[model samples]
Target chain A: MTGQEPPKNPHGDDGPNPPDTGMGMTAVAYLLSGMLVWGGIGWLVDHWVGTRGIFAGLGAVLGMAGGVYLIVRRLGA
Target chain B: MAVQSMVLADVPFPPSVEDFYLPSILPWGEHDNYWFTKITALVWLSAALIIIFFLVAYRKPQLVPSKRQWLAESLYGFVRNNIAIEMIGPAGVRFAPYLTTLFTFILLNNFWGIVPLIQISPNSHIAFPAFLAVISYVMFIWVGIRHHGFVKYFKNSLIPPAPWFILPLLIPIEFFSNFLVRPFSLAVRLFANMFAGHMLLLVFTLGGFAMLNANAWFLPFSIVSWAMTIALTFLEFLVICLQAYVFTVLTASYVQGALADEH
Candidate 1:
């Protein structure tokens, strides 16, 4: 749209690093899925233990941490 | 949504979601019959138009390129070079055809949402976008599998460069995000855009009618509503092109990711 080229580099076989279309999606997915998956697992654990959502809360925090780690490792430059 | 046209020749007030469904064309007044409807017809029509136009336009390849050929060539060239190649690089040349078809199909279908008489997009239906997402999902996974062996592809996508203790946390997140979320988000994004755009237009257009019918004093407000509908139609046009471009570029990006040898 800028009528100019996106910069390219010689890294992979494709030469051009993928543009910014789905990157936002992948970032969001990783963040949300990390929390939801861990949080849901913790919810199940809570159901089994009959505790009052404490485990779920802990899991959400842990999952959020995992999400941030994944985002940095995978998406961070 | 074919079942939404509960009664013919009568428009509903407030334009509930029921307005999305139009009466079946194949079996006239039968409420349950959804064999063929405006949505179905529009989809088929768009497909046919694209195929026929490309074929006719390029029936005779020319050195100078006729207007039809030029238009057809530019469309293909734009997607091939801009979207496919730009996103996926040189190897993306092989993928230009599919990307072009996807762009045109979605663009046409989304364009229908703003068309005067036919103000509904087939893409407003989740099934269409979901199906397209399925195709992209399958193709990317298949490409990944082929490029990297099945075991390796899974390793590449699911196992990021991380320490072993953190592996448990990271792997599940990777699988859930890459495998599960990609297709779901792809389908939902396009469907939601078209669905919301159509709903917005419907509210503006039908709200004018509902208002005018309720009170003559509401004429000016009704006129303003109609004006808003026109303005929103232009906004819908922008959304239509954007959603189409987004879908194609994302698909190409997925392919690029799938084919990447390293992070």
Candidate 2:
């Protein structure tokens, strides 16, 4: 913690390296898991309530949005 | 055209998934025991090779390093300095041995795909990557729990620094992302890459042979296919190294994230 400075962008721009943030695959994973988990829950609720597939679709959209937001927050930090 | 069609019928051009499902060398029942496959053998071989390599390479220490010792040291240094240190800061030193082992183990197995006799990487099977991913996932969780108490780690991970009202929404998203997604993607990425690369090599090599037997007119095209196969072999060599490095770096980053006081 004391010895090394935080990583800087190799291009000399004020950005973190893609690998440093662990964005590339982890981001994709987050997005996918979000959709699957939330959407699955939604589907179960839909089945119970006998509503059409609407809630599942809504859940997927919400999940995607939440996933992206989470990625932004983590990477930006 | 008739001659071409006739010759083409004699040669199998495209290899299918069946081509990859090679028979086990031992007379073990194939479908009965999932572990009794050629891929399993390769996995054992890779593990043995890694153990033997380091043992032989570092048996003697000298003031001036020998070639074997130098190679071993450089590889260790690369992962220690570049990946673990860069990702985890000063605290990275303790994690270097684990990261180095992960890097070299993966690198050697992935490289076995291009080796003359061993044309298939064990990692082309999903099980190998999934196994590695599970180990990594467990390690990061253990590290996080050790650093901050188990309850605190879960609280920090799931409940992001957000409004109280948003906790319900954020908790599920964060939990799924951190726990479910991380290991799943790690396994899929490695498996998919190796699987596709091996399939592509199979196609080009087999296609060349098929084309050569198809017709005299197709002989030149066969040469082209073979040349492409050779070129892709070199590309796969680069990919093998890159994938190993990428896997090691990501694992280190996860460890770093776990150890961080602040998200």
Candidate 3:
């Protein structure tokens, strides 16, 4: 993924460039929010179910996955 | 003589975080309040300087720009062309004034850290950045709501076009990322940068002073400490300007996201 070439413009047309400078920061914001929101929910569920911290861990993993998905959908487009 | 007194002093020579906690200038009285603090005064001073600068620069319209007019125009042009237009497309023209004001205000206040007497950035206090972030937050939300009606905007924001079953999981993530994270990160970034930068300057400067009080054999090393202080000051100058630019650009990006048609 690190070495991948810039993808060719599928439209084969040169147009105004999309703003890419702030994309990395935006991606980070999305990732952090994802973890916090879902992880909080999971912690609450774990408390209710009388489990240890397992649900919070699971929520963080799922949140990260969701965050990546959102980043890909927004920036990849 | 001052160096001799400092050397003979029976206490620590270096400064501490308490040095940043300046006492309020005004004595407690009928008119005095917590709001009338040094940082508050500096904030007002920065605002006044920005207003006076442009007023003096553009008092006379010039077919061929004067030096002051050229400088003012260039600052405005940079924000308008590079940040506003680059981030939000043609529609960003309307936001040029606000972004330009924010950039200059932040840039001047950050630069205050290096000034001789006023040696701290107001933004080192989180309250300042938090206030600015809240303004940006309101602005983007207002823009989104205006562009898309109230119901449509929230619907588009929280409910990304995903399969129905997945939305239960996705909605929380989307809502958090959009509403909560945006402003929190914005405020923290500026506050942390300014706070760390000022603290670093304090460490080096105080270290140099402390070294000056060492024995005659060790006194020469103070030169090295002072040299490092000077070098760090130059680096801090770049950080001061760069942080201002970053804050403005991120703001424009958030505004762009809100105005975007897609989720």
Candidate 4:
């Protein structure tokens, strides 16, 4: 049997009106923001820990987690 | 350059851990390139296999299908009905095919990492996951901007409805989290999990082999380690499927967010 599809909530309430924009702008924003944070995480880890690999890894994870939280809260709200 | 020279050139390129990674069937110079080289080949092979199998199985569509056809159909319907349409809504149904392909590709690639002979997953490589992440990132951004204008998409992404005073602190963080964090997290999550799982398997399996070199008494302990490796292999299989599902589901969710009016 095929998997069941979930019913959509028609009464869903979105918070506000979003601005209209082109795909390229958003894509560039996502890409550049991620790379910058990645670099920042690396720098922060190297400065604090004096060890690069593991701390950088943790920084990346934290940065990502922080990102996901913000996006979900923003969009979902 | 001749194939022989190229192969020979790689032979002396470096002598390290890679030299130890002799695949059960050396596809000539096939496995010589990079961490994700085998991954890419296997991913392509898996795609080809899936396509061929489906074509052959459903050559003449039937109400009561053969086993192969049933398996293929089940896989298709599972992703189509469960993930794509479910997350994205009826309007999103058209995306089922692409989403289904994506799910299966990631699933096969992730699972391939733990398979006996082909012991690497391309998704475990940062590049492949990064590529997928970028694709997803582009897609969602496209969809979001198409639904909302570019300016609106940006606002929806970061600027939650807030008092003017709150903008000073919240805007940059929101912007960074939404735009920068999404794809990076996506890539790292899959990469880290797969990489760590693989490293663990290597440790257990190799440790067992290394331990066996000890006196006969220590040889028995190696069996326990091997057993753990086997158990972890099963766990890895579960992880492969789970991670693939998570990635696909998240992608669907993001796409849905793009298509829908921002909340």
Instruction: Estimate, for each residue in B136-157, the C-alpha lDDT of model 3 and write its tens digit.
Output: 9999999989998898888877
lDDT per residue (tens digit) for residues A1-77 in model 2? 21234344322112344354576666787688778877988899899999998889988888887777777776656
Q: What is the per-residue lDDT of model 2 for residues B1-263, given as tens digits with 9 covering 90 to 100?
A: 99866766766657887766777566765544454677878888989999998899889966678888888887877787788777777677789899999999999889888997788998998888999999999999999999989988888788777678766766798888888878887888888889899999989987987866766688889889989988999999998998898888889878877877655
Error of 4 at B238 (Å): 1.0
Scoring the B chain of model 1 against the true B chain gives a TM-score of 0.95
Task: For candidate 2, give the lDDT of residue B109.
Answer: 89
Best model number under TM-score: 1
User: What's model 1's lDDT at A52?
Assistant: 88
Better of 3 and 4 by DockQ: 3
Over A1-77, each residue of candidate 1 has an lDDT whose tens digit, in order, gives 12324335413453546547477777888889989989988999999999989989998888889999988887787
The DockQ leader among the candidates is 1
Clashes of each: 1, 0, 0, 11
- For every candidate, what is the interface RMSD in angstroms? 4.3, 6.7, 10.0, 7.5
Q: Give, for candidate 4 chain B, the lowest lDDT window spanning 10 residues.
A: B8-17
DockQ of each: 0.45, 0.25, 0.20, 0.14
Arranged by DockQ, best first: 1, 2, 3, 4
Model 4 C-alpha lDDT per residue in residues B1-263, reported as the tens digit of each score: 57744443333322233533444333445555444445557767888977887789779877887788788888888877677666666655667777777887788878878879877776766877898889989988988888788988887766756667645434565667566667887788788878878877877776665665443467778799889999999999989888888778777766876776645
Q: Is candidate 1 or candidate 4 better by lDDT?
A: 1
Runs of candidate 2 exceeding 4 Å displacement: A1-19, B1-13, B28-37
**How accurate locally is residue B191 in candidate 1, as Cα lDDT from 0 to 100?**
98
